[model samples]
Target chain A: MTPRIAIQEESFDLAAETARLTAGRQDVGGLASFVGLCRADDGLAAMVLEHYPGMTERAIARIAGDATGRWPLLGLTVIHRVGRLEPGAPIVLVLTASAHRAAALESCAFLIDWLKTGAPFWKREEFEGGAERWVEAKAADDAAAARWTPA
Target chain B: MRVLYFAWVRQRVGMAEEEISPPPEVRDVAGLVDWLSGRSDGHAAAFANRKTIRAAVNQDFAGPDHPVAAGDEVAFFPPVTGG
Candidate 1:
């Protein structure tokens, strides 16, 4: 199987990632993807992402595993970038492939939703005037992830 | 035991990682937090609001009541805000 998880500082090629996921696989009928970008809020200059070296990967892999178990996913790819990033830069990508669109779409959503709260990454935003602050977690994100809880 | 801090927690604590031995009464995450908070003003400030802090034991998400022992890695940070 192709590598399903990547945590790196370099940018990734979406086309290449898609090709790799479907390579030699005629079973994949649908693909869903989500890309997260750094936002340039008022006075925002840069955003820096920090993560625990070993725990970050483990947390993401556990989230991917949970998605795979809940959905009929044929393939999955999760890429998260670390280090300083400018506004408009891609920060995360979640791509899911399955035999049908519903599974692909829902699983893609599930992956990103879980990743938002469950992953170990922390973001610090730097404003134009040399002020920096750690971004606070949103209750909305927790609510979003909570919806997927087993009934 | 290794205690790690991240994000603003590290900034407030003034260090990223530290090695220390806690008293026997500090047997779980909450107890550890209480003990650390008393060590210095920085730690006290960082841990002032327990509601905003989160913990992980041995790379797994944990609760305040989670049991902790020697030779374990415990990390504390603010709630995660990643995508």
Candidate 2:
């Protein structure tokens, strides 16, 4: 199987990733995917993603593993790109495969939500005229993650 | 121990990583932050708002009271913004 979790500087091919998980596999009934892109918001020139090397991989793996445990996942892939990236570049990709749509879809959402709060990656946006600032964590993102918590 | 900084913390602290020996009284993440803040103005500024910072000891998320010792890889960074 293609690696279930990945953190690298190079971009990912969504089609290729999807094919890898589904190819020659009748067991997979559904596959859900989410791709995050770098937007040119507020005249931003580019952004750089920074992460803790060993910690980032482990953090994401833990999140993926949680999804695997909670849902019946047949296959999963999480690719997050580091280093400098221009606007319109892809930032992250999440793919969750399962025997049904609900498990595939919900687990995909859960993985991304938890990744937002629990993962160690950070983005530094470089705006026009050489000014740059670290992207602030959104309260809404925290709220989004919180909704997934089991009571 | 090797301390690492990322994102704004790295920029403010003016270095990516460093080796430091805190006094024996410093036993956890919070204590280490307090001791590090005394090292320089930049260090103080980087850790000025403890609420905005997060810590990891030996690559695992660590709370303020999380035990730490020598030969650990501790990292401090702002709240994660990645998806």
Write one digit per residue (lDDT tens) for candidate 1, span B25-62: 88999999999999999999999999989999999999
Clashes of each: 0, 0
Q: Clashing residue pairs in candidate 2, if any? A: none
User: All candidates: CA RMSD in angstroms?
Assistant: 1.0, 1.2
Per-residue lDDT tens digits for candidate 2, residues B1-83, read: 99999988998899999999888999999999999999889999999999999999999999999988999999999999898
How far is A36's C-alpha from truth in model 1 (Å)? 0.2
Q: Candidate 1 DockQ category?
A: high
Q: What are the per-residue Cα lDDT tens digits for candidate 2 across A6-115?
A: 88899999999999898888999999999999999999999999989999999998888788888998999999999999999999999999999999999999988988
All candidates' chain B TM-scores are 0.98, 0.98
| Residue runs of model 2 more than 4 Å from their true location after superposition | A1-3
- Residues A1-151 of candidate 1 have per-residue lDDT tens digits of 3338989999888999899889988999999999999999988999999999899999998888888888888999999999999999999999999999999999999989999999999999999989998999999999999999987
Scored against the true structure, residue B38 in model 2 reaches a CA lDDT of 95
For each candidate in the order shown, give its overall lDDT on alpha carbons: 0.94, 0.93
